[model samples]
Target: MVREIMEEGLLTSRYQLPPNETKPTSNGADGDGLTDNLNMPSQPAASSLTLVLVFCTFVAVCGSFSYGCSLGYSSPAETGIMEDLDLSLAEYSVFGSIITIGGMVGAILSGKIADLIGRKRAMWFSDVLCTVGWLAIAFAKNALWLDIGRLLIGLGVSIFCYVVPVYIAEIAPKSYRGSFASSNQLMTSSGFAIMFFVGTFISWRTLTMIGAIPCVVQIIGLFFIPESPRWLAKCGREKEFEASLKRLRGENSDISEEAAEIRDYIATLEQQTEASFLELFQRRYANALIVGVGLMLLQQLGGNSAVVYYTSRIFKESGISGSLGLQVLAVLQVPAATIGLLLMDRSGRRPLLLVSASGLCFSYFLQGLAFCFKELPNLKALTPPLALSSTLIAATAFTIGLGGIPWIIMSEIFPINVKAQAGSLVTLVNWSTAWIMTYSFNFMMDWSLAGTFFFFSGISGLTVLFVAKLVPETKERTLEEIQASITHFM
Candidate 1:
């Protein structure tokens, strides 16, 4: 029904490149679309060779991994914490659901903080918050402490989710930016998987402590990495911007052309009047906003959060051992993330999203079917395998596209003038929708397990149409060109 609603509006116009615009290809070196202009001669762009760029991205995504730890923690730790603390199901649910509330707050302020101090500083501040949150969790004596700690960690990771990807996109050379920016989600998946696996063996308190380690490592690592050059330029710190850009590009490579292009772009943006929320409503900004916010809405509403948040519970209900089920998921997500990283640049975003969302629709329908069959004595034998396959397929399908592309597209499509505002709005909606889904899933399942999944399946089905009709191919385009193409349609 949601698919039908969206199809009526979006299906009429197939996505087409602007008539005068030439589509950029990755056929040549420097093909990730960092050219001075479409008409300009091709310049040298090294392919993922700069150690500083690599290291910086690695450091930034440590925060992302920590963010994932916060997300996956509640699922495996749920049983242990409830037993150890002697908490009610209601209390534990509060502990689990409060993170998204914190996340909403963080999303609103992430852009301002990143712009105020710098990306590294914003990350450092987030790490400190996460450290405090984890310590609070580790030492909690009561339910209040747990909720507060969880909320703190949630807030920190909310900032990490927005700032980390944006930082990587700003600093990374266009050649492998897609793959590098994707490392944010890669580490996040790894974090969730590792936490679940480790939680199977360790206590909840010990897992909280383990979560702090990455933040500490990121804090130390941040000192060595240069600030984002685009940010520096945005701040009018011309010398620092040059130094940072050169550092990221490597000293031997020619940075002059790219530097000039960035400076010119920044200069043009600075000359424009400041953009407010009202300006975002202008006809020119319509397509970018729709695609950005629309993808985020689909990602969260499709039930990724509920699945991760209740993986162990779902498995247990299906007559599988929750511990072993979590272990399977621990092993499953990493390979899926690797596949996504490999295909991010190669296959492009739109095709992968369509495929992933279609798979999710099928997987969730299968899950609903499994639950439906559980009531029939004759088909009871099929429930376990069907449930297991559905879970694994859903996780894999989510990681392949919907898990990361929304954030990637959020960073790519918006022009610098509106990026902060647009990013915050998208991030807020993503977390808000996530909160509603995660908080409601348990009750919905109690009402009817099959109904809950059928709802998610419907949302997943709508996502395929959303991408096909609305999302532009952002594969190898420069950030400038991407904005241009999006605004062209508007």
Candidate 2:
């Protein structure tokens, strides 16, 4: 009976209901100029693909841009901060890795915050946190101050990890949802690329101040956008729900069918007992939890974050111009992310995941081989170019799929009822593993560069297997349909 109700809810939400079914409306008095329709088909408004969506998505991803800034800040500032503060490698490492500690704590609470407040308010809260963090970093006079600032920024980033993609997913029309959701990654990569490019010309203090710009932009922009229609419906705010849905779909678009479908799904969800954290362990949610959390593990453990965070040092150690290498990374990151955004909906999720994981394996393998050749005196000259090429390849390949798809999948797979808990759990795993990998990366590099890349290469290979065997194709599916299908598969 439960499964049957779920399917009913999904089908209604994903498709137009029959003309005979009257939609839930405020007694023909909706001030948004919507009319009662007894003989109409439920379809997206002719203007469903509107400028408002584009603008709103852009605004929401400003938070993602801030997140990228926070991540990239330590890389460029590493030398300056260490020199100016007379810090050791250990101190610098602590400064660089402490963000993930904050990220872990924030991830654990991210969903609860989003659910407790609304999506827009959560973003507002995040922007405020990040702004303060950047300010703290900008004026820090000691190592203690720097570490404290980085931790606060990390907390903001943890919220970004969950909310940005989820916000984009909720607001976008199904026709363009994948591409729009891909924008979160694009903005994030742009953030990293921007810092990398701009840091070349600016002081570390100036760059930290620049980091606060996006937070302000996002905070102000949040006031102009509509809250998530889905979120409003879930909260039982019927009038606001209708208004938000109408605003997204357009004034004249027939939203009755879509509204009815959403209300039905919410109604079905309401019939079930409210779930607790422990309830997530049930077999019903296992596939989603596994896929969501598993991809996060694979993404972080594959060494992308560590590589991104420590690229300059890696290049210096390999006898390449660290500055030149960072420049090349800055140039390539956005184009790669843009390509992924364009391809997100056109190519299915599974294919992209497989290709991304495969490319990462090959790139890491090549880097490992380069480090191996470094030990051979005759082949020492080849190591620099090989390492440089491999870094570029890895950066490009990572952005192409793994960078964006995991979050997209996370936003899509879970049912509405368990979305908060599921998102938080997956996000927590992602950050915790990220923290462990990032914190340990330097030590691992010290142990053996060849071993480090080889280990990452192995993990990348495992990711390919995991995606092929377990991950589902979510292209073109409504959120309801995606969750229902995953449940059936499990």
Candidate 3:
């Protein structure tokens, strides 16, 4: 059956059985008629290399979080900075929007670059861009320079966010893929958590400069990790792929079965080389693209960035004063997001998204009520701190539900052939929406905090409905399997 499937090109090579596997061997090798020439060494116990990869991912993702934190915290601080620099709100918003604009371009282009140059090269490029962007921001004497700096930083973030998950997904074994991929989100939230505190202590300019430090660590760490085996196979470097797999799986490990699996998967991909970005819109690919794009849009509309970018503003509107409110909100995000990350792999994608979305809806609804009732005869005495605390709780709920999962789902939804492009498209939508919310949030706040919460709540409520109806569960599937499944939806 397996042979028939392979020969028909219906089964991916990764799923193909060994030529003569009539019986299973003690080593989990099938004793099919085919010779097992490649003996995988005893699986190396988890090593420093694994730690190194995790750390690299952490550092790479920190760039993303730093960008988010800097953007979020910096926006409010701009009120003060604008006086010093002689800038208008619109000018400041435009400068902030430059990051998303750069991200949109980067997200669209980085996939093609990663596909051509490989993931490692892409990371190195990202680090260089990050360093340069931060330096520009740190020294900027004018609004134009600041916007230019943000644009560069946005470009770096655009590439890093898309590339890191793809690299981690491709490199991790199937068993650990969920946990490993979720690590990107964990680190991202951690970055947000750290930035809140950092922003609290330092001037926004200093905070922006501090964000550059992680990229240095990322550039150095890249040297220690092996190139992705899947990328190697995609580049038609079979020997290199074998060596990479050996290093990742361990030199003394038994990877013959694994190698065979990869070879077959690559063969299947090679057979379909005509697939292109436009093909992603064709009937065969459209379903996956829709899911990918919809989830991206849903994530933004769910109001995660609105809260992240404006938590301080939201609190101040509710009556909380000083930078301390921002600090408290930031501190809350760490544990809330940490809890969400811990549950991500175990809870599966679809369920958590649904639950989180629903929670967000309820939280936002409450926030709206809190706003509406702020001047109620009986509730007029409620302290600003208490109202802000309620808003923080709502923001926490928003982060867990929609903040991290969209990135995870986007990373998992596409096949290797179009993964980068599709991922970039989705991320582009994400950042663009982020820019819209970030730009308009102050206006919304000016209208009413209750009104803003209500707006976000409506968005979150819609997302819950859409995800429940349209999104597929992608918890434990391999990349090939995810592609196959999404193909059906399309």
Candidate 4:
């Protein structure tokens, strides 16, 4: 009987009722109370909700510190640490890549866990893993222990990244979705900036420990936020969903409109069969899977990871003295990322992606040219700073374009039936590519710096082409609409 009621309610609403359904007292006297309330937007009053979202975003995005510190501090300090530990470049690369490998494994596994246990719970699990990883790294005496610790931290970061955006998307209203979702990227940049600054002042061990601090706070914060309403509905927890919606939307606001939407979404999901990893290759979902994997792969191959992992080395190779140049580059990331957050909603996804890719490719090409002509008398004096600056520009552009988009698109592109599994598969690919790029870059640089920059430039150019040809613009589209479009492409 309950199932029949659910089906009837869902079909009547066509997967989401009009917001007007939330009229006070279920009467038309006030003419759709929820709609009237939503339309009556106030500036300073609305800012409170925005502030709450930003705080949640900050806590969720703190996961990036694990990735940022690992990339920034460890990449630059590897040579120094290797000298102390008597390790080879290959061994160091293996250790560095282990984190990505762990992330790949974790991302593949965490999605279903989040689906089953809820997004908030999954995040708490991540916090525990992050704390353990940091504690392990802090006290490590051998390279093996360091790798193990890194692997744990990577696992936490991967899970957190996968879950946070989904949670934000599920909770945010349609009007504010873009801004709220983009906050994840802003927080990631903040994490990177913090790590870079902290690494400059402290020992690598201390930096690692400090990076773990945010995860502790995140664990506490998770308890304060409501669980995702969509997840609650999926689990047949109608009462919980209704209560969560009220809290998220506010006490005075009616939730029937949003509740109806969740009911419809759940019903549509119920009509589909469960998805397996093998189904990712099936016709209905294959194109989306390809796009997801392609985006992840392109993001890494665009040279962001290489630049981030080797910022200090790149600066030193360019004949820039001391660590000051690296510090300046790190500081530059803050504003670049801020600009990205601002442009993301306004410029739309495809335009920003193409522009960012073009800029990245051009930056890499210029850096390659500078490296190639380092011996030229006239160019010699300016080669070092110019090359470093070009690389920084490339990194910033890539981060603005690809870093957050892949995660956001991956979370939304797949249908509800396959979302968890498909998102995990895409995230797995993302981490795997990160591992490959980070591991291969040192070897590529060893052969020739020019060769390395040229390789990445070629990849960035290819990414622009891919975006033009295959990737669809998803800005401001409903999840159902985006799914339908992808199905057509498939």
Candidate 5:
């Protein structure tokens, strides 16, 4: 429903910022065991954007590309599937919405799977499931087989939606971390765009095979990538942790400062009790939890998911050619995502999110007006162009910020002791809300086309305030600085 980009990852690294933008004071540990608080002298930041970091990120985001393929595949293949299988509207709706159910299931299991199996392994496993799912769809003759494939694909993608971003964060060079992280959307945009372009020329079955390629790519790519260093640190694999960090940082680089910081911080985390799901609600965690979960809630409620899954319908309803409109939408994603990559750290998360959300509000308002005009006897004749224009603006806004920043915020905000628990909670909320929004969208449109858009506009307007009030400016700060500010170990 997020169209693979909905309510998902965002941010940049320290690469583009000036050397002088550093904090005046150390944000180390509390009187607690956290060492960063001790004013420990900083080491030479590895300013190098090494090939290793880039390759690992590329591998991780192959999963993201596959995810986009999965999201985009549905729209292109929909007409063909319904015709071939003779699915009733209700049956097809299940195929359409079943991904969210699997996503919810994956969300529930994702944090635990990644934490238990290691990020790289989790990704490998997810790709396998996706590959199998695609194969099932490619060969399926009945609705049951199609649903099973779709369900498996959704389960796998929801995991990618979590691990790929987290994996990128862990390996990314702090300098351009946000930029590097933003590449997830870039590849996703690429996959989505490619699917739309090629689907017109290929059979639905052939499309399924194309969608499976990235899954295989990621599976192969995972072999070359190192396990997340933080994960290794968490697992007490000192040698492997250092090795992974060293590989990520570069072979010749001095890993001592970074290594010690990670070790000490993890040690600090080690002293804290691992929080259970219920324990995540404690007052100390209240702020971080609110930011993590609130962003996810508002992100979907803003109607990105609805607009995405039904864009073609929206176009057709406005009397535009749905195929032409979808192609146009496909054309817009890459450049928009590219703009997001360039701007993420330069603008900072809060500013970009504000601009993006505000842009969406404005766009959705325009769309509401378009629908309102459609209701007018005379003005109705001219509403199609307006609806198309407004939809494009909304899509662009979504790609740039609201689409991904919440995830960056989520990954950065949670303390290590409860990150897994927090991740499960945050991811679960995201997919669950997505399902609700996706499910209700058509009904809302039926009730009132103009009203439906106005409702979306209102939610997006509220999102602006929510982000402004609660979302922190993560920028180039270390994860320690972010968490410490929220939890205030003092």
Candidate 6:
């Protein structure tokens, strides 16, 4: 669930460009033209004007919207696509799940891609891939082309799922970081909701093309948004970093304290031996590593992907009309995302996760029972509304916490030096498990729909324990402070 929270102190500011503000002469330290005249103020920063921060977040979340469309597209598209291509259930299942396979590859490369090319460039590259993927799907006449297109979309979405949140986390102030970063999931919900509604009326190919429009918007937007200042500083481009940070903070806001804090932290990271992907498993890093990967694993295994991708099929297979349920879900997602956004910083991560996982357990149990009821005498009448209610509850619970908070915590807990390694591994595990479940979901449903849901319910129950024991509250803390508290128990 996502809501648009107006960030404090920025919405009503008298936004105006300075008369003397000149374009930076170069990409060096003066690129933003702030270095020579920038004052190193000793006082703590009061507040930042966030128009640019808001705009940059909007651009980044365009990728997130595309990601959501890719996930939500399969359900409404499934029936039409099968008829168009004469696809077998197995073939269509491959088409549905192929994105996760691509996601795995992209996850492996996402951190490195962000690190090498910079966050802004990585998003731009992913948008290009998604655009091509959508075009391929829009024109494909056969199953092979469909799978290839879906795979490309998956590859791109995986990178987006990793980079967008990380980029937002890096650029946002600690106070606003939770809500701003959570906006990534908010746009995702919007995309998924729109696709579910539109696909009901349009051809699958047309729907695929519609998905590409966001990609185009994001690609053009990349030129206007600044790269993550922390990333620029990581690369030792101090001038550009200051310039970028100053722009994000607003024309008049002082950038000195925050800039120095970032520099000091990055400097401290350079003193340690940076861990490779495998080295991330070391005991010293175990707390952060387990929390990151464990949450990702549980997030997928809880059946969000499989359920979302096949919602229509699930309803149809139960001999109920899914359109009403789908519509309700689309409507329900708004408040759900809103609730999550509103409570993100206020409720803190741990409580929300615990409550969400607990709700998921109950919702899935209802789903299993709803499926099970059809088999019993005189109970077939109850399946429709019961099934629909379970789905809405499950979705609301997932969105409220488990859906996006793992990502928020993932971005916060890792030090920049190992963020790439840790992020790649975590993202890969997420996609890998997603692949296993999504690819097998149809077959599993055939095996026993009730059984499949019960299994997912049990997994969610375990997730409750996992969060209660391991996941830490990361509210209201700087990234540096969060990482230290996570890994420095020694």
CA lDDT, every model vs. true structure: 0.85, 0.84, 0.70, 0.72, 0.81, 0.84
Give candidate 3 misplaced runs (Cα > 4 Å). Answer: 1-49, 52-56, 375-377, 383-386
Candidate 5, run of 10 with poorest lDDT: 7-16
Residue 199 in model 6: shift from native, Å? 0.6
Q: Give the 10-residue window scoring lowest on summed lDDT in candidate 1.
A: 7-16
Candidate 1 per-residue lDDT, tens place, 88-176, comes to 99999999999999999999988778877889999999999999999999999889999999999989998998889889888876668
Weakest 10 consecutive residues of candidate 2 by summed lDDT: 29-38
Model 6 ranges off by over 4 Å: 1-45, 488-490
lDDT of 2 by residue, 150-266 (tens): 898989889988988888888776668889998888999999998888887788999998899999998899999999988999999999999998887778778888788678767
Better of 1 and 2 by lDDT: 1
Q: What lDDT score goes with residue 123 in model 4?
A: 89
Stretches of candidate 1 above 4 Å error? 1-48
Tell me the tens digit of each residue's lDDT in model 6 across 1-490: 0111121111111121355764334453113321222222222535564889999999999999999899889988888999988999889888888999999999999999999999999998899899999999999989899988999999999999889999999998877788898888788888998888888888888899889999999999999999999999999999999999999988788888889878877776676565577767665568888899999999999999999999988888667677766777888776888889898877778888999999999999998998899898799878878888888899999988998899888898888888998889999999999998887787889899899999999999999999988887776666765665564332
Which 10 residues in a row give candidate 4 its minimum summed lDDT? 34-43
Instruction: Quote each prediction's TM-score.
Output: 0.92, 0.92, 0.86, 0.86, 0.91, 0.90
TM-score of 2: 0.92
Model 3 TM: 0.86
Highest-scoring model, TM-score: 1
**True-structure RMSD, every candidate:** 5.7, 6.7, 6.0, 6.8, 7.2, 10.8
298-356 per-residue lDDT for model 4 (tens digits) = 98877676677667777777888536775777787778778877887677677778988
Q: Record all residue pairs in model 1 with backbone atoms less than 3 Å apart, i.e. clashing.
A: none
- Candidate 1 whole-model C-alpha lDDT, 0 to 1: 0.85
**Whole-structure CA lDDT of model 6:** 0.84
